[model samples]
Target: MVNTSFALSSTTRRRLSLVIGAYTVVVFATIVALGVLSATASDHAPRDAWVHAIIVAVFAILLPMRLRAASRGSLAGLRAIGIISGVLFMVNVVESTLSMFPVWMRTEMIVIALLMLVSIGLVVRERL
Candidate 1:
């Protein structure tokens, strides 16, 4: 059910935005780092890293638009952000477990997952 009456406070909304922005920065950084490592890393397939980076890049780009909508009190926007955050969390969890990337990258993935989890929680709890 859509909770039309639910509205995020400015502080809460800013927190959500911060989470989203931080996630985006981390994601782009991951992509850049992956690209740099892909040049010399022989332990993992460059194709896999590139694919993951591309997918995350798309999500990172989409977030600001969704945040704008949510900030405007659009329920669909809020739901979209929550859903994206949850999906990214799961993706990062899986990535963190893979042996394909270096240990440091995997650790970064763990950090990304945690951040996404926080974002998801913020969106979900506010809606609730």
Candidate 2:
């Protein structure tokens, strides 16, 4: 049923949702582990680390809600999130590729870009 309407089949949607979910989990674990280490070891908080952690933490809460909306067949919501996340990831990928980030970081960016591109594909698939 999902496949008929979107580029992503139900299985693919489920898998991608799981991937996003896992990514969120990793975000939290990184924060907690880093936070604990920083608390015990550092006299002052690292501004950059805290900012990055907080941002990813927000994604931890938001992405699942968006995925739920998307999985529930909300076309408008899906399109909005899909396009926004897709373009954001695409831009990040290009930026990372051109930046001085190491090969591994660029590779990770590419992977995330692929996932978001699939999401965008699903959004556009509705019209095809």
Question: How well does each candidate superpose onto the true structure, as a TM-score?
Answer: 0.85, 0.61
lDDT of 1 by residue, 10-107 (tens): 98789988887887888788777776766776454366767877888898899889888878878888889889888988988988788776677678
Clashing pairs in 1: none
The TM-score that candidate 1 achieves is: 0.85
| Highest-scoring model, lDDT | 1
Local distance difference test values of all predictions, in order: 0.80, 0.60
Q: After superposition, how far is residue 3 of candidate 1 from its true place, in Å?
A: 7.3
Best-fitting candidate, measured by TM-score?
1
Error of 2 at 6 (Å): 7.3
Q: Give the alpha carbon lDDT tens digit for every residue of 1-128 in model 2.
A: 45423333586567657667656666677577557757785433354445645765676677678767767766655666666666656665765555444343345456656656665665566446
Global Cα lDDT for candidate 1: 0.80
